[model samples]
Structure formats: C-alpha cells, structure tokens
Target: MKTRILSLILLTVFASAAPAQKNEQNRPPIIDAHVHAFEKDERWTHKVANPLTGQPMTATTEQSHMQATLAEMKKYNVVKAVISNDYQAVLRWKAASPDHIIASYGFYDPSSQDLAFLRREHAAGRLMALGEIGAQYEGIAPNDPKMEPYFALAEELDIPVGIHIGLSKPGIAYDDAPKYRAALSNPLLLEEVLIRHPKIRIYVMHAGWPMLDQMVGLMWAHPQVYVDTGVIDWAVPRKEFHVYLRRLVEAGFGERIMFGSDQMVWPETIGMAVEGIESAAFLTEQQKRDILYNNAVRFFRLDKK
Candidate 1:
C-alpha cells in the first residue's frame, strides 16, 4: 500500500510538471550577442577595489567555470555569444569553449603591446570585431593616439569595433579625478573618433545610457553605427527597453540592433535578457527573431560557416 501511494504521488507531480516543461522546451531559441566568461584567477578585482571601478572579468575557477558557461548556453538555447576579454586571463574560456564563445583579444593596459596583439589576433580572424574598447574608464578618450593603431587594424581587418561608451555605476572611475557619472557618459565623445575612422564599423555597447536619445541620434547619423543591449537593464526599465526599441525601429535602424545579455553577474542573466526582449511590447514575433538571432548571424558573418 505504501509503495503504491508513493508511486501515485510521483505520477501526480510529474503529470502536472509535464506541460510546463514542454512549454519551456517549445519556447523560441535565442542568440546572446554579448556574454562573459573567465577563470577565477583572471578576475580584475585586484587591480581595483570593485569590478564597476575596474574592467569586468570572471571570478570562478577554470574547470568548473567553463563547464557552467557551456551548460547555461545549452540549457538556455543560446546559439552564440560575442566574447571579449583581457589578455592572459579568460584565455581558457576560448580554449575550453570555442563553439559557444567567439573570442576577441583586447587588453585594458594602454600599451603598444596590447594593440600589437589585437592586430595579430584580428588578422587571424580570431576576433569578429575590435572591441569592448573605447574610453569607459578615465584618462582615455576615444581619439587618443594610443588607440589609432588598433583602429587602423580594425579597418584593415574590415571588422566592426565593439565599444563601451556609457554611464557606469556612481563609483566607477573615468580617470584619476572623475567618477564615471551620467555627465561623462555621453556618446558624443565618439564623434571625433568616428569621423576619423569612418570605414571602421562601430557597435556602441550599453547604448550610451543617460544620453540614450543622443546615442540614438548618433546611430541615425552614422550608417555603420550599431548598438547592443548588454547590461542596459540595470539602467533602463523593461518598458523603456520597448520604448527604445520602438524608437530605433522608427528611426530605420531596427535591423542593426543586437541582443546582448552581458553575462558577468550570473549565467541566468543571459536568460533574463532573452526574456526581456521577448516580453517587450515593441517586438513582434518576427522582430524578436531578428533581434535574438538573425541580426547577429548576419553581423558576425556566422552564416558563412
């Protein structure tokens, strides 16, 4: 009698769970444009007190971290992620998981060696684009001569540049003196650099928050300009995401928009970004498909493979 009761209870629970599980299984697939992975020792925290104040890196150990990243991608139906990381650190991410994570080489250290490495990796087609670069932190401006070589390499390679130009947290430093605040996060600073490097494609990360209108205006003005929705949720509300998407669509640049989860805090963050895009009122079924995958496929030239 006890065994029969236990079996019946198990059957009842599974019967109720089946449809919900099926619904999840049947949900549309997603392609996360932006995702992050790194070994625990690769963390940039030691360079600075907080990650916001410093460059972003992972804190998990190599063996388990790589497995977790792959598992999350498989479980969430994430087709691919355009990955960029510092030198030395996060090398295992690409070595261990190449299919899911497309790696790019860039180092925060502003030296010729960094640019040289970027040029070499770019020439080998190891990097799809030139960045997660630009002057998010202080003491670096978009037009700094130090960055010209990398820009030139990007032009020669004919790949887009992924730039992070937007408001960071209150405590994050832009330089020795100023913290990365709303005022300094303007996308207009990129104007001079874009003018100088017209041939180079630029994907402005974070969509230039606090100056979002200006960012949209910049994208409208520049034909090669694009934006990715990475780590923007913390700044923009869910409704605002729809509003922004609709605005971009109305501006005739919907096709250029890419979805990025900015998966540093957690693996589930990727799923959250996909859910946000799906839940947005501005996106129709077709638009959702484009934002989730098709756009990235075309932008990254993934279809060629």
Candidate 2:
C-alpha cells in the first residue's frame, strides 16, 4: 500500500513538472505573405523596442539575421515567404533560400531608371512582384498621379503588388517620415486607383489597420482587393488585433485575408505573428488555414507554379 502511494505521488510530480505541449507540430503549413530582407548595415546593430510591448529585440548582424529568420520559419513550418528589399539584398536572400523566398521589389519612388531596371528584372525572371511601395511615407496617396505608372506596370506584368496603406511606427511622422499622414492610410484612397486599374492584383499591407469601416467598404466594393496582416499581427495589442481580424472575418472577407509578419528586424516576431492568428478563438480551423496558407496560394496563384 505504501509503495502504491509513493508511485502515485511520483506520477503526480512528474506530470506537474512536464512542460505543456502545443499542437504546433500538427499545425498546417504556413505561407508568410509579407517579409523583408536587408543587407548588412550599421542600423541592424541597434536594438528596436516593440512599440506595444516595450520589449527591445536582440540586435543581429546580417548573417545572424538571415540564419535566425530561416530558423524561425522552419520552426513554425512556414513553407514560403514573399520577401522585399533592395534589388541586390533580395537577390542574395533568394540565392540562399530559393525554395522559400518569393522575390519582390520594394521601393518608395522609382526613378525612370528604376522602372527600366524592374522591367528588365521581371523579364529575366529575377523579380516576381512590386512593393511594399511606401509612398505614404512621402505623404503620397494611393490615387496620386505619380503612382499611376507603377500600378500600370503591375497590371501589365500580371504579378502581384503589395502596397503600404496603414499605420507606421508610432511617432514616425515626427521624425523618420515627416511627410507621413494618418489620413493617407485610409483604404478608400485606393478606390480611384482600383477603378482605373481593374486588372492589377494588389493587397494592402498591414490590412489598413484602425480603418475598419473604410477597409470593409473597399473590399466589399472591390472584390479583387486583398490584404495582409503584417506588422499588426504581432506589433499591436493582441486583443485589438483579434478584434480587427474578427471583424474582417465576420464581414465575410476571411477568404481574402492573408498572414504576414512584416518582420523587418526581429526574426522571432515571425513566430509571434503566427501565434497571434492561432490565438484568435473566433477563427475556425479552416479559417485559420485559409489565412495562413490557402488565401495566399489563391491570391499569388502559387498553384500555377
């Protein structure tokens, strides 16, 4: 009887000491629709704090950043990523991880020479998409005439485009981007552009956060438009992010929403971003799968590849 009691106590202790297991191993494969790559630069040496959490991310060298990002992707079963950066930096990442990387050209304002370069690169199959086109940082609206040619080019190529349309870093307008305006983040600004270029496959980056009504209206009006939950997936408070996402899903737009990390400097944010969607109780198993992988597959036409 004493021996049986001791065994029972040992069993309880062992069970209590064991680490809780997550079903992540059984989780469906993911495709992060937004990611960024960069060359070795002094800027990477500085730790940046997460605006919502006040937690400073670890500083990383270019090599470490690439290694950690890839490791995180593997850990989370991320099968593919749409990566944007300077031409050469993106090329390097693609060369290193050809199977996982979808190369995109990220630009603010493209010079005539830059446009020519993009044309040549796309023809040569070096670039697949155009954007994080961040003209908003320059206070340029999506309907600005200056953006027309870029949209035209995207339409002509039949490749996807991801545009920055929503909130930037807190206080970014005060310093980093003096021209930045919150008003330009409105999804409604894209209406004219969308109407003019009906064939362009474009997705709003950050899902046009905090502009729920405008975003919903835009998507309802323009069925071709899609969105990526980039920085907001992990950068915003979880409760707020979930509420916004739930609204989009409930509004019958779940099929167009895709997962993105917008993982600029912090590699671990990739996993955090995935967890953000996984933690949403309102989403069904199929809805979560669609957001994580299927939606992007359909949007990007990956099945054709």
lDDT of each: 0.61, 0.82
Task: Write down the worst ten-residue block by lDDT for model 2.
Answer: 1-10
**How far does residue 70 in candidate 1 sit from its true spot (Å)?**
2.1
Please provide, for model 2 over 126-223, each residue's C-alpha lDDT reduced to its tens digit, 9 standing for 90 to 100: 88998888888888899998888889999999999999988887777776678888899999999999989999999999999989999999999999
> Candidate 2 regions off by >4 Å?
1-25, 49-56, 111-113
The top-ranked prediction according to TM-score is 2
Runs in model 1 deviating more than 4 A are 1-29, 41-59, 174-181
- Give per-residue CA lDDT, model 1, range 29-81, as digits (tens): 56666665554432222312122222222323545545655666766677677
Q: Each candidate's TM vs. the true structure? A: 0.78, 0.88
Candidate achieving the largest lDDT: 2
